[model samples]
Target: MLALLAAQLTLALLFGPASAQTTGAVKLATFKGPVTPVLAEYIERAIANAEVTGAAALVIELDTPGGSVDITKTLTQRMTSATVPVIVYVAPRGAHAGSAGTFITLAGHIAAMAPGSSIGAASPVGSEGGELPETLKTKETNILVADIKNLAARRGEKAVTWAAKAVSEAAAATADEALALGVIDVVADDVPDLLRQLDGRQVIVAGKEITLQLSDLPIETVPLSGIENFLNTLTNPALAAILLTIGLNAILFELSNPGGYVAGVIGVICLLLAFYALGTLNANWVGLGFVGLAFVLFVLDIKAPTHGVLTIGGIVSFVLGTFILFNTSELDVPWATIIALALATGGFFAFAIGKALAIQRRQPTTGLEGMIGQTAEVRRALEPVGTVLAEGELWAAESESGPIAVGERVVITGHDGFRLRVRKLTREA
Candidate 1:
């Protein structure tokens, strides 16, 4: 029995628990990610799958640096009241249940963590990752304290304070401390060990404490689908920002050079996705406005020659807006992204303005300006000036040399109002 207990303890230390049964024993699904919409969706789907399969319970493997307080609460409720028992295991070494993760772990029917794992830090804040004001923080702390306390009440008060400290002081206790304080029920070496240790442990489930008979239960790992992976990838903050940039550029490009539906279509798609992501993550609208203002400055600079002053302002606004948009609690935006956008934006406007100036300096090619290079047949001969038919009308013209013949095609070198300034196309031609 001593050796058996030691062996069981080892298995619990690891998330890789042996199959509880040989066939049709239980279904264990896994999802490890941030608390994003896609993750929420995957959890909901896993719960549904567990119900359909008639499994004993579903185990959710979690490892996240808390996100969106609202989403955490929702996931907590689902775990606590799941029709099938919900086992939330904060698994693998070095994993943690910070902020929202504390609530989730406590809500589970059986909360367990691997060695070197931790849980705590359930403080709440606004969506932009800023600390809530003192008053709001107090209120938020009180609410979360009550929440975790209620869950911990059935377990113990020590667990309750630890839970609160997790959010209040950003406290984190190791797996050993957590188990000792009753914050977690078990600390197995791995999944099989967890099962063995839990084979007959009495725990309250749905208001009834029953020994879980999970021996010989087969465990199947349900992973996120391909579609879910794709959605999750798009939900990244950086990716969303990139999409926004691409979409905005595409639409602007199409506006400058119309008649191409492809750019417009892609722009619309990317913009829609960017809006959706920003909405979901609850981005600061002020930052968004700043980004808009930056673009406005850019367009204004393009239209009116500010001699690069507006362009400089536009670049500064854009860089600041991009940095502010993401709400980084860490090391701000990537230097590479900023450098690339600055170089690209600066080059774009400078090149455009240069091209416009070049066009201005070039010789005229339309209307009266085009009559300069043209040749015409003199209706009557003259020493210097004479009436000539050219450019679809008869005009008074002059030649520096001999008169030209009729029906000759000539280049329009210059134009002055109604006069036809004619010249031969080429000496050889």
Candidate 2:
């Protein structure tokens, strides 16, 4: 019994540290969209959680077309300095790490890609998606090139050169090409495969070199919170443009016929949401101005009887505005959708305003003015002024042609205050 106890103690001491090192779970998170502030927050939270939980490593499955540069910088900085090793994998067969995505992928301690996935295209453009002015473009491009070079340095000179070309010329590479160029360390088929490949890989984490023991570890997926999901949806450029259009039209409808607060409330809500989205997307203010002008023209057409001329101009302005609003190289806003929405909005307002004007031109149907051209029975003889039944009520009336006798029918020709002017109805012989 004494010998057995001594052997057990020796065995525990020999393997305990190795077993403890591999006990923690691996953390996983998916980021499949533009890089917005919400995405940055979510990643930051995930990293913090991993650190708190003593996770073996944090894996970020990324698929994005790109997004705000400032947000991307924030994410890269956080990821590069994280306590736990971060593995950025471009996954799901055909996903591409574009523009800002390139910076993030390179920032990871272990950069990887799935089979058939791609990376690169890190060119810097204006915030509004247009080419920057030459001098500014040079300055911004140089800054980005320097940053990317640093991120790719550990991968070797080939990767560093390719990364610079990606920014200067928008160069892209497939998974196999990236692996050959040393831009990525591995090409995996899926998450499980990624872990298998990443096992035993050495990575630098917070200034210390560590080997990943990721095989067979439990993976805990971190999902976006409700608020994060909602904010992510607001990052869509097309959705923002549509919201702007609907909000303007609704508010205009409420202003034209202001009674129920339903349209007005809905309009305000939609506009607020749209503004949030536009601000996130860095939409062109000139496009917003055009949209506002289009609505203004619509109101003018309704008020000033412009014979549809102003309405046509409003339609043109609306289409132009929508096009400009979503004109970003990072996002592909459908032209067909923009044109269709503009035409529909313009046609609806034109028809609505036309109907409203027609109603206004109609003769009065109920009031003193309504009594004109109406037939009435003479309740009392009219010696130029007498009481007569008009519209089921007795009214003092004056005869325009001559004195009207009692029990005779008379027609109201006009009204002065409450007195109606009447003329005896003549029966054609």
Candidate 3:
């Protein structure tokens, strides 16, 4: 170990100031955007990377408008149970650590923030999708409050008021306010400054005290790799919603017009993706039931003849179901998307119903059925039987009770043997 350290130092020295700045130094992990599953995986990967690279410490830079409660709690657990000391930093200008982010900042081995950054607003918002159930809401709030308070107490600080306020009142505080309230440990201008500030700080990691030696150390930005990037892409709200919509549409299209291989394959693929996202999001099954009910109603409206009345009911059900579709404890669903889908569903049904009704009501203009009730010309001599020209074709004709005359206009009264039964036209008739 001594020899390895000496060799590492030797390499750093030979490489001059550039490499000397980074040898056996701090590694950084950054968290931006929503508190998604990809972010959780990224943090785990960062911890693993730190262990393998033997980094002195791992600093997680965070900036978010909050995220899912379940994911946030999992991330918090990772931070609290980390092998290498985990430093959570709310960074840069104009960044906020709100809602679930507040808990994350507090759960770190050492919480730090940039001078202009802020944290708190620890209220439990829906999984960024829709409102949660009342029972779930109560249970989640109580549990999260307890957990955050426990983390705070273990860190040897006042946590009761702050944690309770975050959950109950949706409290928020600036960096300076957080430091004043002991919500965070330190506030620095930048990463280098943070390192300088954290050089002698003692933190408990894996239940052991580790002093951070980060002063003047070159920071290695350990970002999420390609696989992590792909996973993150999969967890994106837009992408997930798109998969969900495509899956739903495919299944609906299949149901509307059954026995198609292409639609089935596409539906299965999209549904698989949707299920993956739903699992990651910890979505509520009840919301899924609502969506299913909406689909059922939509199908019923299309299949049954309700004269568009069922279709109107279907639109209402669809809108409500779509809004309730993602109401879960773990993450939020996009409200705008739900609204758009409702509008789209209404439009598609309207157009489809209009076409179907028009087809039903259309006047027949061709074939034998079309010639009935049309006026005709007498073409043959008939004491009571004669040929008549009707619908641009001449055919044998007869009158039921009287003889018809030839070369006279007549009115078709009925059909008899591929021809029209007509009565001769009188003057002004």
Error of 1 at 54 (Å): 2.4
lDDT of each: 0.72, 0.88, 0.74
Cα displacement (angstroms), candidate 3, residue 278, comes to 3.4
**Rank ordering of all candidates by lDDT, starting from the highest:** 2, 3, 1
Ranking 1 against 2 by lDDT, winner: 2
TM-score, candidate number 2: 0.88
Q: Return the top candidate by TM-score.
A: 2
State model 1's lDDT. Answer: 0.72
- The candidate that wins on lDDT is 2
lDDT of 3 at 50: 77
TM-score of every candidate relative to the true structure: 0.81, 0.88, 0.68
lDDT of 2: 0.88
List the RMSD of every prediction in angstroms. 7.7, 3.3, 6.4
lDDT string for model 1 (303-361, tens) is 78565777788778777777777663431347678667766876786676677677777
The sequence of per-residue lDDT tens digits that candidate 2 reaches over residues 1-429 is 999999999998996654554568999999988888898899999999888788888999999988888899889999998989899999889998999999999999998999889899888888877889999999999999999999999999999999999999999999999999999998999888999998988877888777899989999999999999998998887788888888888898898779988999999999999999988877888888888999888888887766688888998998888788756555745787788788888888879887978888899888998778989988889998999998778999999978888999988899999999989898951
Better of 2 and 3 by lDDT: 2
- Could you tell me the lDDT of residue 110 within candidate 2? 90
